[model samples]
Target: MNNSLKTIAFISGIVILAYGVYTLFKPETQISIGDVDLIETQDNTNSYITIAVGIVIVALSSIIGKK
Candidate 1:
């Protein structure tokens, strides 16, 4: 049971990390009019937070697994 839980955490962490990276690089808003492109960029605070959370979770899971 514990191993299964750890596996789930690891998978979820990877997914969250991937999602954070995707959001960090992807544009939030884009508009193209007559060959003119307008992109609305936002701060990456959320992405950073998500990435941090994922890293922490992964680290915790691995650390616990070693015990």
Candidate 2:
């Protein structure tokens, strides 16, 4: 049971990491309203920072699971 749980946790961690990476590279689009063009800015640095935090959480979970 413990081993299976660990495996599941590890897989989830990998998925989160992948999702974070994808978010970092995903393109942001914007629409124009009337005479104004609305631009949606995607800050890659901020996205990467969020991903780093997620990775840290996953790492912590993995560590706790080992116990």
Q: Return the top candidate by TM-score.
A: 1
- Ten-residue stretch with the least lDDT total in model 2: 58-67
Report the C-alpha lDDT of model 1 over 1-67, residue by residue, as the tens digit. 8898899999999999999998899867989999999988789999999999999888887876675
Q: What TM-scores do the predictions have? A: 0.80, 0.59
Residue pairs clashing, model 2: none
Angstrom error of the Cα, residue 3, model 2: value is: 0.4
* Cand. 2 Cα-lDDT: 0.76
Residue-wise C-alpha lDDT for candidate 2, range 4-67, written one tens digit per residue: 7767766777777788899888878889889999889887886677678668757866786554
Regions of model 2 farther than 4 Å from truth: 30-38, 43-50, 61-67
Q: What is the clash count of model 2?
A: 0
